[model samples]
Target: MDFWEADELAAHRATARAWAEANIEPHWAEEQHRTGCHQTMELHARLARDGILAAGWPAEYGGSDVDPAFAQAIFDECAERDLHVDGWTTTSMVLHTIAHTGTEAQKHEYIPAALRGEILIALGYSEPDSGSDAAAAKTTAVRDGDTWVINGQKMFTSTAQVCSHIFVLTRTNPDVPKHKGLSLFLVPTSAPGYDLQPIHTLGGQVTNATFFTDVRVPGSALIGEPDGGWNVMRVALIYERGVSSPSRIEKTLAEDLASWAREARRPDGTTVLDDPLVAERIGRIAVDEEVGRLLGRWTNWQAAKGGIPGVEGSMRKLFFTEAEQRHFSDALDILGAEGLLAPEAPGAPAGGAFEHGFRAAVVTTVYGGTSEILRDIIAQRHLGLPRNRPGG
Candidate 1:
């Protein structure tokens, strides 16, 4: 894999960086100041209007039809500036799957509007009893004439409070095996019987517990063939797990730590950064960041070649999340008690970003998929090992 971006991507990155500085930088601190999920419709629309939101999508779907790397360039710019695109990320995952598997009518109705940032979709996969076992969903959707009546709950439904719809996984045919009985739906959050309550995490992020009590959606809401949701979900998870864009958190943290260390002094009056141990730890972080970036680039390259990343997604996901955990631990240790300070606290290093990141990194290993589960996937799917779970 090329360590450097191609000329076209490099030029695109320059443009994206300028756009982010003008549009995102001014408001970024305010967004960060807020406790959780701070995406706003104004910013979302601006991203679309600037052609950054869907740059890699097909031309008919409000995109420029450039290589997928173009979209990744936009993401890298945002991350370098500490701009949160969680809302767009989840929406894109669902939209990508829809573009591939949805009916023509469904495509016509949702695609353009979503790209224009008129609608947002939240993931509704985890249930109270089904954390990593998404196929074991108990959320039922029963067909009644032309409508489907849904009744159940979804946990960790991030962005539900602000999203227009939820890409839900429901048990449509419980008589069949767990994975075979499922279906997917694009349920409107505005519909009656739909409700959500917030779930605050230590990371200062807000997810939700969503409830559906006889929620009725038209047949058009069905994303793919009934009992074929597992396959549809696999596609969406590929987008989620795959390193379509590299995460800059670890990189940012290391930079911040180095900056703080440069200004910090030891009791002996020498700079903390002058210490060999501190330098070695930061060096380790840089190495990890580069490896993770290359892994992401490999997966993105596959997508650019019109192939969806398979177990390679699992590999990147596992490596990146675990590396993130390790990076933060090292950061906190280097920063000492001052590192634990919250953002608003006086004299906090890098505005307490490392502190908040330390907390935030805790969930990276849990969401999307757990580290343990990802390892199992890598073993069974990538390594050709027998399934560790029973009855496999």
Candidate 2:
């Protein structure tokens, strides 16, 4: 598909650039790199009030109702400026799914609230034993009178500490097969009997481990249908991977690497970027960033035309994440001994962003879906190949 932005989109891009320049705090990028915290809800609310956060949603739902290309331009601009838009993007995707499949009452109640940036939703698909094997989820939700009683634990749930609600998957019937008996529910974080514990990672981000002991919600909390959460989750997963932009991580690393290469002098007073090898490495990373952008545009085009991203989304997710890891690894190699310094050290390069990135990149390959799983989908579904065996 032709993925170039059109004239109207270019106009939108200009507007986005100006808005970002005027409003984005000067220290926001450095703060995000150092603390791993995006702007607060007050900042989010300001963006929402200015119609930036709801750029792609329909007008009736408090969005701009702009074309998908326009939305892509906005995302590109945000990435170019080194902004953290993942939390906002994920919330919008979940809101879109609700608009498409939710009951009228659900849309009336949640869509406006989400667009207003009043409610932050956390995804609850992963469990201690069911990370990639989401179908093996054992979280149970039993019907009692007019409510569902949930009892299970969810692990590696990002942003659960600050979210208002959780879009969770639970097994409604055990007699059914692994993928058959699951159901999706919108559980309020304030619900009685729900407990959350933060999981600190090597990279310093805080994900969560949540336990539900007789957590009860009304039957209205169910989304789509009972014993059908697998399908709902499949749809949500497609949106998650497809709408994701590589700009945040890629831009942050690229700009940092360039700045460091320009400033760090060799033993003979030669700068790193002046080295042919360093130039080649940066060129390759730039190419990967361009390709990832095109892949994202293609995914958006498909969605705009009423088709799901399918295998293409997996390809983009796998390629871009791996590219991010490779880009930073090359930076570390260029820095040599200086790269080993921790962020807390007195004179570390880029405040140890590369060091943190290396550890974080290891987790990226495993999260969402592993590179191995994405490769399997590409072969089986995209290439129409018979499943590979040990020696096949």
Candidate 3:
């Protein structure tokens, strides 16, 4: 796939980089101190207000009507600097899903405000029992005249505590097959019977276990048809699984390790990079980063051509996340005992970010879709293999 950078895209990337440095980077310290890697919507609002949040969307939706790659530029710049954009990304996924499946009234109520970053929405799909098998979700939303009463628990609701609403996948008609019986709802966090308990991961990010006990929302909260959540969820998952933006984490990590290795001297007066094994590990990381980058850009190219990635997206996610885990582990081995140090600790390599990243990388293979699941998709769709799962 040809991903040659055009002049316009290059210029847009420059502008996005400058904007991020001026506005977002300043809040990094304070935001980290306050939330420990959880974004509080301050930066998100600023991005929306400044028109960087949805630059690829139509003008009526507060965007510049440019190629999505323009927006992807901003996302990539932020990621390179270690900025958190999960809240923005997840909210945008929900927003786009709503724009496609929601009614005029629903659009009028939520879309504009969301495009302006007036609110944040979290995803409530996974449960204690249904991790990757999202259709198996047991969260129920029963119709009650003009309202829908929601009652169930959601696991790994990543940004639930900071979000104003949650786009929940609920079981609306259990008498039918699991996938056909599911429905979607936008539940306000202020409603009674909606609760969340923060779950801090080893990766230094905050997620939530959200509980819904008789929570009631208006009928207008339903997205798409009553029992058509699977279709709605498919749209959302496309965004999640697709390569919407570039991530330079492995590249950045390799650069940092290389810098450290260049100066690190052994007792024999040889630098760490001079060691054959260390050099070999760094080489492997660099190769993985480049391969992952090309895979992502290829998928992005497919999207630009109006194709929704199926096996291609799964392949990108699978390779990128798995490579990320390996890169972090390799970084730690290169740093030796110094890798064990936490952020701000004395003499910690890469200021302990790599150590934190190593912990965080463990979850990458599990979220979005597991490595095992992605393998299934690639096998069945790309290789024409027999369906392995029940519904497939």
Evaluated with TM-score, which candidate comes out highest?
1
- Give TM per candidate: 0.94, 0.89, 0.92
Task: Please give the TM-score that candidate 3 achieves against the real structure.
Answer: 0.92
lDDT of each: 0.83, 0.77, 0.81
lDDT of 3 at 35: 74
Poorest 10 consecutive residues by lDDT, candidate 2: 243-252
- Sorting all predicted structures by TM-score, with the top scorer first, yields 1, 3, 2
Error of 1 at 74 (Å): 3.7
User: What is residue 242's positional error in candidate 1, in angstroms?
Assistant: 0.3
TM-score (C-alpha) between model 1 and the true structure: 0.94
- Which candidate would rank higher by lDDT, 1 or 2? 1
Candidate 2, residues 21-59: lDDT per residue as tens digits?
A: 776676666666555544345546666677666666667
RMSD of each predicted structure: 2.1, 3.1, 2.3
Candidate 1 vs candidate 3: the TM-score winner is 1
